[model samples]
Target: KFEQANGGTILLDEISEMDQGLQAKLLRVLQEQQVERVGGRKIINLDVRILATTNRKLEEYVAENKFREDLYYRLNVFPLQWLPLRERIADIVPLAQRLLAKYSRKMNRTAVSMSDEAQRVLQAHPWPGNVRELDNIIQRSLILQQGALIGPGDLHIQPGSMHTAEMAGRINSVGVSQADNSQLGNDMKQHEFQLIVDTLRETGGSRKDAADKLGISPRTLRYKLAKMREAGIDLDAELKG
Candidate 1:
């Protein structure tokens, strides 16, 4: 693979997780610039650029003798450390919006736009899981939300290190109430139903347009309308022109 990517880059993510034996092998490959395939006698020369990332402090690992000093030196020729999400507050909203757009297209949902309140909630998060966490939150919200606009109620943010008791108090001060675990399911269902109705109203009872706005399929909207009719919600009467 290195030979194939001779002029390109090979990224080794989470390099700290590599075992000592594998580290030694990697060091030999980097130093020698050649590799011998298993059961093959010919050694192939490599001209690939190597890039690696590690969440842990490699210097600490080196001091503890958990990582090979020689290998560390070879790989640490140029190092760039990324600040955690909590520290990079400016990036949170842009990153979230980008991910939202990506997952929206992938899931075949309408282009979901973020509400200012939702953006605030996202910005408040500490993001212990970093970009991966933001990605998951956007994906989950896209799945749960039933409106063109994603609001704070649509997000299910877990409390993190930065979300301390003081932060909770601050959130409450801003009129954002955290739901009790027991009531969360019912509350979410109510929100989803309301969002669906609002979208239908906005689109003048056009189910396809409403479904597009709600990030759901037209068939799904029909099924939901059917259920609402059975539940005496009278959506048809309400939506009639």
Candidate 2:
């Protein structure tokens, strides 16, 4: 195709999927304005502009010799790194609005707008899949709703870290591995136990409001308090009434 289309642009979607050998061949084409197609010796003179996208770090691959250094250099000529959606919360509302308009027409529904609380939750979310995930979520929300206003319940994104990579120990010291999860659960229990003890002191050992504030059932809180007592948590002395 290089011979047929001598002066054109090629979009290499997910270019990182190319092997090192193929990357080296691509580098040659980029440098010399020529191409030798697979299983063909005849070199074709071409003036093709290359546009590529990769989510992976090409330089890291080049350093590991997994990607050709020369190819990486050629592609890095006018590199543009897009910030992930999590970093650009400001774009969330506008992007969601756009998607709403687009899918509404496609699905033969009235255009929808997100509720203020919905927008707040959407903006607060860490969108790891970037625009693609947002698109899916909007589509799902639109289809699920009969009304024109989208609520926070419509956008079912969980209210925390959005990816396995994001959940792993980088910002939070709590790693997301199985062992780390066990430790995290234990730590959370300890923290909760301490908070309950303190709250009990403030309420003069009243369990009702403390259970309400903590968003747990009274029975559940009592069960936890009993467990804490068994573990030798000096609830009364810690409170020091």
Candidate 3:
């Protein structure tokens, strides 16, 4: 792949899936910017850019000794963590429209637009399967669609599916009181917000440690903090109190 993409970019998709042996070779190639062609040792010296993606946590994999620590550091030059679709509610309609156009072109259909109600429906769903789920649903809607607008009926999704009680976690570990727990029972969002606050305080405001305790990425924790602030939760005040 490096030889094929000489002077260009090559993506190592799901890099964590590469075993130790392959990881060693890849690390050498990335470090030297060169490769030896199989069955022909001409010592191909090439310039290439490397990009990688993975769903699993590579840091955890390194700690578990499943992934090469050196390779993890080499590929950790730039990391980007994208929030799940449900968290990116504002992007739903635009992404759907883009996908609709893409699939329409492939299907040889005229331009199609989602109805206002249909847009609302897409945004309302939890989207547990994320963008791939959205992609499949849009394709199905395109096929079942009538006229040029994909209406509410054209779309299909199981209601109340894959949502684990608004992703509620064990609040007992946070050390909240019985009275606060009673109020938390009434409001799930507030419960989650308070949980994060308590965890941060327990970690002495170390976001990384708090994220590790909460079993979420630090970037996700940052997003939650942003949401809490947007909801008018005074983080400083909460931390002090």
Candidate 4:
């Protein structure tokens, strides 16, 4: 990959997960800006700009001796902290708009757009999975959308997942009360809650199978199940033995 990105850039995502052996090799490569192929006598030079990203705090990893300290400093040059998609509510709609156009062209759909209500829904979602999750939602919604405009009903997000920005947005735009907001939040979650329960039953209470069917991570499914448990929904009584 470094040889291929000779004059451009290479992104090493999830850098914190790299093993110690690989970290040593990467440190050497960064210092030398060169590489050699396995069981070969040829030395290849590189001019690639290295970019790395991690969802973890590297300093903590380094302090714990999980990551190399020298490599951490080497790669920390010009570092940028990316706020989560839920925090960057301002970027949500614009990013969605661009993604919509891109997907529309790829899918051979003509000039699809988002409705005002749909935009509001997009803004409201907590985006637990971040932009990748947002990408999934938009792509799925495009298929569900029947017309040029993507409406709130077309969106796949659980209705009850609320963000602070969403609450502010609602108050400013619709003059909705806190009480009304609570009701909307509660009602929206029922659909998602039921779907999960039904899927669990069909999978014979196998969460992994249900997660695979639902297109969510097992961890996410576990979290959802925890929420249901908190809501006093007794799933144990209903699941197949």
In order, the Cα lDDT scores of the candidates are 0.71, 0.68, 0.74, 0.72
Give the top-scoring candidate (TM-score): 4
When superposed on Cα atoms, how far off is each prediction in RMSD?
13.9, 14.4, 18.0, 13.5
Q: What count of clashes does model 1 give? A: 0
Could you arrange the candidates by TM-score from highest to lowest? 4, 1, 3, 2
Tens digits of per-residue lDDT, candidate 3, 1-241, equal 7888998999999998998899999989878878897888789998887889888999999999999998899999889999999999999999999989987776566868889999999999988778877876776566434368888766755566532212222332333232243333334344457667776887789999976655557898898788677666678878877
Indicate whether candidate 3 or candidate 4 has the larger TM-score.
4
Query: What tens-digit string does per-residue lDDT give for candidate 1 at 1-241?
Result: 6767777899898999999999999999999999998899999989899999999999999999999999999999989988998899899999989988886776566758999999999888878777767775676576567579988866667566422221212111211122232432443343444555656767787889876655557898888777555555556655552
My TM-score estimates for the predictions, one after another, are 0.63, 0.55, 0.62, 0.64
lDDT of 4 by residue, 1-241 (tens): 8888989999999999999999999999999989998899888999999889999999999999999999999999999999999899999999999988887775567879998888988888878767876776676665435378888766656755522222112211222122233332443244355556666766778999877656568998898778666666667764532
Candidate 4, clashing residue pairs? Answer: none
Q: Candidate 1: misplaced stretches above 4 Å?
A: 161-241
* lDDT for predicted candidate 1 compared with the true structure: 0.71
Question: By summed lDDT, which 10 consecutive residues of candidate 3 come out lowest?
Answer: 163-172
Output the better candidate (1/3) by lDDT: 3
Error of 4 at 52 (Å): 0.6
lDDT of 4 at 239: 59
